[model samples]
Each structure stands twice: as structure tokens, then as C-alpha cells.
Target: MEHEKRDHALLSASGANRWLACPPSAKLEEQFPDTTSDAAREGTLAHELAELKVRNYFYTTDFGKRKLNAAVKKLQKEDLWQDEMMGYTDQYLDYIRVVAMADRIQGTAEIEKRVDFGRWAPGGFGTADCLLLKGNQLHVIDFKYGKGVPVSAEENPQMMLYALGARDMYGILYHFDEFHLHIIQPRIDNVSEWTCTEEELLEFGSYVKERSALAIDGAGEFCPGESQCRFCRAKAVCRARAEENVRLAFSQDKGKLPPLISSEDAGRYLSLGEDVKKWLEDLKEWALGECLAGRPVLGWKAVEGRGSRDWIDMDAAFGKLAKSGLAEEAVLWEKKPLTLAQVEKLLGKKDFQDAVGEFVVKNPGKPALVKESDKSEAITNKVTAAEAFAEGGES
Candidate 1:
């Protein structure tokens, strides 16, 4: 999959979720440069690792074996390896196997399978994380490494695109009548699934094909919304989005009656709290960018925040301090690495943790509500069986 050049498609299935909503997004995005992030690299590595595992165990194919091995070696050398990532991949493999067994199929798994939707989507093609066929049912599984937001499959265009593409690629031979789409987002503990018949699938395709064609020609309509704009590259300078957000502020600022806000007004403002916060953050980023380039922003100045002191040459400074008849301990705070409780009055947080970080004590976090599916093992745990049994017996 890495061998394929990402030809900056006018429409791609991965961005289908965004382009379908804001049809002009793909066209506008072409104006900005595509930058890779650490998060994206980690996601790619995770996908590679998961694919390697699945193919090694289930299907025995040497497709991209040499390239895959090299990529796997490169990823294994990275510091991004985490237990949960491996666990998530395992869960994905397990789910596929379970489904395959249930449907009386074996060795139907296809890893990193590229599918082309042909005329159903213009210049549309994407690699499904995993694709398999079981009788008349066609199951498409996608793995998402993001923990930010849970992606749903209800009317999901990306999954729909993959389904259509897979249909185009393998439909001739298998003649799939049923479709089951699944999204496994392990980082957020979100496992979402949706099923649709072949008839309903084609009905949704008509809308995608038209939208995709318009998007490819840069003739798509500009529709702005929170979901559509979240991952958009042009969002920072998009006039439509700026205007939409400005309307909200305009609605809030008109005709102020009293010093104290009414309950209704307060509730409305509270409802828009997230939007306001994001706007402020974007404003700060813009102001900083302008300030750094020596273009001063009105009513805002750039100033350095509080900074810690550091010696120009720590070893030389220590030697110089000792030569000046001052003890080394006086100039530099030196102590054996140990906990405060274990060795009290040793050093301050600035002195010790700054120098010997291993001795530092990490703070325990506050309690917060979290989903049962949360794998953090944080917040709090429910009552254990033993505790429940003891309480029940006591009562």
C-alpha cells in the first residue's frame, strides 16, 4: 500500500466523510500543502503492524512481504510501540476470525486490499484495512487509531465508499447481496457497526457519485458545519467557516438588556461554549503567527513566559565554582536519586526533578466520569465481586 503514490485525488474515501458534507472541501484543500504529523505516522505504523499480524496468521500470501518486513522493522524501532496498540490489533484479528467462523468461511481475509469504485466515485480508490467475503454477506472492517472522536457508521460516506469500491473490485465473482461495515477505533474504545442491503447501498451511491464529480471539477457547493470543518486544511482561512462562526457571535451580542444575563441567554451561550473556545484558540494561533513575522497585531503583544535558569556550561561552571573557594554543593544541587518520603529534605522540585528526574513523584489524577469501554484503567473502578459479596452478606 505504501508503494502507491498518493496522487492528491480530487476525491478519496478516507476524506469522504468530510467531502460529502462540505463538497468543496477537497477542492479547497488542494490550495494548502499537505503536512504529515507524528500522529499520522503512528497510525500508519499501527495499520502496518496490524496488517502484518493478520496476514501472517490467517492468509498466507507473500504480497509485499519484503517491503512489509522492512516497514515492520522500521516501525518496531520506533518509540511509539504501546501495549494497547498491539491489543487493539489483536482484537481486530479476533473479530474477523470470529465472523469468518460464524459464516462458515476460511482464508477469505484480504489485508490492505485496494478497491476502485470506478464511475460510482470519480477518481475514487482506497485501501480497506481488511476485507472479507462470507457467502452473500460482504464484511468491511476499518481500524482507526484516533482517540479524539468516535466515528459512527450510520450514513457514513467513507465506509460506504469502501463498500462500493469493494463491490466493484470483487462483486463480479462473489455477487455480494448483503453488506456489513465495521469501524474499530480502539484508542477511544469505540466499536461501531452498520448493515445495509445491496439495494440501499446503490441508492446511497447516486448521491456520492454526483457529489464526487462536482468536487473533482471544483464546482461543489460550500457548506460549513463543525463536523465538516474539523479536519479541513483551509479552515484557518476559510471565509465561509469564518462567516458562519461570526453569525453566532453576532446573534449573542445584539441588544444587551441588563448587566446580568438571563437564564435563557446564559444557556444559549453555554451551549456554544466549545465553539467560542475553539475560536479563541484559533485567534491566538493567528495572532502569534503574525507577531512572529514582525507584523504586530492590534491590542496584543508577544512576550516570553516564565523560563527556568540554566548554566551555559554545567561542568565548567561547577569546576569554576569549586576553584572560587565555593563548595560544589553550594553552586549545584546534587543528591542521590530517592523519593522525598524515603529521603526527606534532599532537594526541591526544581532542583531534583530537573536534575535527577527518576526521583520525582508523579501526581495522581482527579476522578472523572468515563465510559466502561475506556481502557485507560483510570478514573475509578466499579465495586469488585468480593466487595459486593461482603456488602450483600452484611446487609
Candidate 2:
């Protein structure tokens, strides 16, 4: 299905993770006008390209190949196509094909499959990137082209909703026993997979039914958190979220007291860190948006941003150089192949392992101050929990 045909509803399945947490966000977001960024458009194109490639592999190659090429050329014409985008899509295709190899004889695969959960969520519908079914198990593969943050599949509400929707769509047709959720974020080398039985999925459906009803009717409370408000449209103007952050961040640590943080307070601060970071970023963006639109905030005003220059017409410049009779090699130099990180991203983990793994040089990065809950060990070896307090430093 073409992404252009995909409609944006106030309670979309993609934003289920958000609205389910902060139920009022569904209604709050409606008040703000919907707008798509260039990144979103590029992601749409990547999804289109991925759909085309997967379809070609499974069904039509000669005819579908033509359509795929045409779609790519159109995107290239608009300067939306990039080498990196295709690499990401290719990684998605590679994963699908690899999984297909496991059940090559019995598995059924569908691309851009639509699922509707309007029974619980009013007008709830979304297209799954890919679904593979075999015997009683179904695999739901979602391709996230974004590189900003690594998304995990373990108990991920978004992927769970996709699984629920898939079950609703194909439950009767195929009596699947297990649903496997796969989130392949090629840019971040994040390939997380989680499996849940039909019982677990149905249990989640109960939660979905209760929360979705509230969100669809705009009746649930605005309980704020990092996961919910990170991409929320109303986060900047969310009174509940603002209040929650202020309340969480306002510490009662007196100067007379010991600098050591109690275990409970440390836990609380850790939970607040993500939300505070998101709130600060969202507030900055909101202020900037308001200022750019000629409605500057009373206290915070906008200044010219750090800007860079770009070539007006690179082709024109190259064309003139071509006619000047200078050696082509002298005018334009060949670039070396991308570095390890770049090549790994270009080829993906599996392909990179097959092609470039032998060339990788492993090294440990210098660790910094991370939460006590972090998996990695601390860089400073002297102290552990209250290292900051032991030293003459603020906790």
C-alpha cells in the first residue's frame, strides 16, 4: 500500500504507546495542527521502497522491478533518495529473507498488511511492514529508519499493539499460537526480538481495550512519562506533563544534609532523568517554533542559529570544470571507502559481518558517569555508589 493513502487519525496505532500512557494526549494533540517533517517524508519513501523490494522478492520481479525502479527514480529526482536509505531498507529485506529461509517450505509472508482494531480504538488501523506466518507462529517485522534512539522490542507497547492488530486481522484465518515481535532499526544496529504466546497477547488486549476506550473518547488521565511524551504532539503545551516534571525535579536536598543520595531518592531521580531531558528539549523546540512564527515567548527570544553554506548548483560547477580541459582526476578526486562504522551501517550487521567483519578493530570507549542502574561499570575506580559525595563535589 502506498503511504500517501495512509491517513493520520487522532488515535493512530503508531501513537498507541503514547496515548495509552497519557490518554488525554490523543485529544490534546488534535488541537495542534498536524505537520510532517522532511525526515518523516524520507521515512515514508524508505517504507515505500522497502515494500516494493519485498513484494518483488516474494511475488512479481519483472513488473514489480519496473515499479520499484520508477519509484526510486522519482524519489531521486526530488533529492529524497539517499544511499543510506536504500541500505536501511536492504537490511530489512535481508532480515526477512533470512527468516524465510527458516520456514522456506511452509511460511507465508505478506507485505504492507493492514490491521484494524476499531472495535477498541475508534478508527484504529495501520499497515504492518511485514508479517510471516508458519504453522501456528507468526512473525511481525517492523522497520524503523530513524537513528535518533534505539527502540527495544521487549514489552514495547508499539510493537505489542502491532501484534494485537495482527492477531485481530489474521486470528480466525490462521490459528497462530505464538506472535514474534521484531524491531529492526538498521541505523542503530538494533535488532531486538520478543516472543509472546497467544494468551499473553490476548491478556494485553484486555489492557488495550480499557486504555483505548479512554483515549478514543478523550477521557483518560494525563499521566506523563518519558516514553509517552517523547514524540507527543502536545508535549510542549502539556500542563500535566509540565507539572509532573517540575514536581519530580524539585528536590528537597538541603545544603546542611549529607551529599549522599538515599537509595530510594536515587531511584526516583533516575526515573525523572529521561522525562526531564525530553521536557527541556521540547520546551526549547516549542519556544523556537513560537519565536520563528513571530510569536516569541515573553522571556526566551530567538537568535540566529548556527548556519552553514551549501553549493547552489554542484552540477553546474562540475559541468564548467568538465569543459575547462583540466584532467578529470585533478578536478574531482576519488573518495576512500567509508570507515568501519560507516561501512557497518551501509552493509548492516549481517552483511557487514560477511564482508567487513574481518577488518574491524575492537576497542573500549572511556566510560563516564552513568546511573548506578547502568549495565556498564564505572570509569573512576575509587568509589561506586556515593563517589560524588566522597569527593568534594555536588551529588
Candidate 3:
């Protein structure tokens, strides 16, 4: 599956959350060139593969099937391709089938449909991964291949913008009464959805119009917060964000603490700590980049950090070890069983479950403090302790 090239809007739907919060950031980010990371490239590959599968399944023809097979072969030859991608994509396909069945309407499914919402947002348009229209209902399904952060469909600016664009494009023909936004993150096993009435969707569209007007010209004040700043291009040197985190870090007089801090103060500091840490890391990365580019930071200089050596020819090295009477299993190599996930992918899901499902057991995850808005259910201390004890006894 070859990657498709798409033009990005200045106020891209994907970056709407950032620009909507801090309007000036849309302009501020323009000074920096857009860059793609390995993770991003891998995600692009995954999306391409997914689109191929969707087209093949929904609009199947002999030629389309042949094209799909050829594309899959090309994707497999890519450097980023992994064996697990097939299984993950199959899961996504299964979910799409379920959604189609639930819709109960033999509606049309468009792949990589381009939509425009320029009526509300100036020059706002994006490609939706999939759009299923079923009897006055519009379904926008987005595939998120990244595993680092779980994205939700509830009031998500990106998904909302996608939905808005979709509606503008299809509303006249379909007279949509409801909009369904879905995010499927197969890598992290997250599937989230949010449905909105036409009235609610229009109300949100008006809000987006107001914000887009401000964001297009970078007319609003800089609002520095965690979620918006996380992916901002200028975050490394953004004075507003720096001041925000710095003020939080030194809120107490002389940056000092009392002899004993109250629990409330401790909780506040802990929440602030994450932002401060991220800011510090960004600052260091910026300085390193400057130094590497031959621009001197006040007290920084680029230098070699560390290095390690590896065998030039593993087979030759191992043969030499054997000549010295070293047992292959003793030092050269050792056998280990595949991890649960690796085995699951190696054998299909049903086969793997039939083979070793009884031997497999899942332990309770460790408890961690998170924001109240997190979707995960809160665990009580009693349950945590009991689960810990149960695992200990089993061991």
C-alpha cells in the first residue's frame, strides 16, 4: 500500500484542539517546518493498509481483489511492515463489519472521502478514513495507529471537525439527523464512540466557526495548557507555556515548602510536576538541536555521548567460539518461548486460544493516579490490596 500525499490546511482538523485553545499557535507553528517521525510513517503505512482492506471488503470486484492482493504484497515488502499488522487490520475489519450490521441499512461506504467545511471554517477540509451513510445517519470512523495516547471520540476537536466536514458534504443528499463519530485504536485495544443529534452537531459547528475565525488570524490570547501544548511545534520555546509551567513550579514563596505539606498541596504539586517535567525535556531537546546545528546555547556544546560495538558477522564469531569448544547453547544462544502477543499473532486468535487459553492468566494492572476525566474506572484501595494478595498467593 503506497502512502497517499494529502495537502494539509493551515488550520488542520488534526490540530484544531491546539489552535482552538491557543489561536496564536496556528501562526506560531508555521515558522517551523513540518517533520515526520518513524512512528508517523509507520502509522501512515497502517492507514494505507486499512484503506485497502476496506475497499476490498466493501466494494469487492475481481479487479479490486487483485489490486488489493498486489498492494498487500507491496506493503509486506516495506521496511515498516510487521507480521502483527495483518492481525490488527483484521480486527479493524471485524469491527467495521459489526458497525455495518448494527446500522441495519444497506448504505454506501466511501473510502478516503474528501470533505469540505469551508462554510464555517476558512479553507477547512480533510479526508475521512471511512464514512457510512445509513438512513439519515452519518458515521465517521477514524483509524488511529498510534499507541502512545488513547484518543476518544467524545467532543474531540479532530473527530468533530471531521464529522462537520462530512455533514457539509453529505447532508443535502442524506438529510442526516444524527452523527456518529468513532475512533478505533487497534494497537492499544481502544474503541471509542460518540453520537450527536443534528441540533447538537450544528451548535458545535457554530462554536467551531467562532473559534476558527479567531484561529485563522491568530487573534486570540495564548492559552498554555497540557493537552493543547503537548503537540505544539513552538512549545519548546513558547514564552507563554514557559511562564505557565514556571509559575506553577515556583508558586510557593522562595520555591520553599512548609515543614509538613498538606495532602491538598501535595496533590496539586504532583499534578503540576508532569507539566514541569515535560517543559524541561522540551527545553533540553531544543538546546541540543541548536548545538547540533552549530548555534551555541549559552552553556551547551555538542559532544559525542556514548557508543557500543556489535558483532560484524555473528555466524563467523559463533563458529570461532565453537572451534574453542564452547557449547552453542551455553553462551552463543539460548531458546526462549515467544511472548503471549507474539504467539497470538503467529497462530490465529481462535487457534491460539484453543491451544493455550487455559494456561494463560491476566493479572490486575497497577494502580496509578490519573485525572478525573480519564475513562478508566476508579479502583478502591481495598480491591487493590486484595488483588495484590491474590497474585502473591498464586505466585
Candidate 2 residues 125-202, lDDT tens each?
777888888778888899988877677788777677777777777878889888888989887788989999988988
Q: lDDT-based ranking, best first?
A: 3, 2, 1
**TM-score for each predicted model, relative to the true structure:** 0.74, 0.78, 0.89
Give the poorly placed runs of model 3, Cα more than 4 Å off: 1-4, 253-258, 321-331, 365-367, 377-395
At residue 380, give the lDDT of candidate 2: 50
lDDT (CA) for every model shown?
A: 0.76, 0.80, 0.86
The better candidate by lDDT, 1 or 2, is 2
Q: What is the lDDT of candidate 3?
A: 0.86
Error of 1 at 363 (Å): 13
RMSD of 2: 7.2
Collision count of model 2: 0
Higher lDDT: candidate 2 or 3?
3
How displaced is residue 270 in candidate 1, in Å?
3.8
Judged by whole-model lDDT over C-alpha atoms, candidate 1 comes out at 0.76
**What's the C-alpha lDDT at position 208 in model 1?**
87
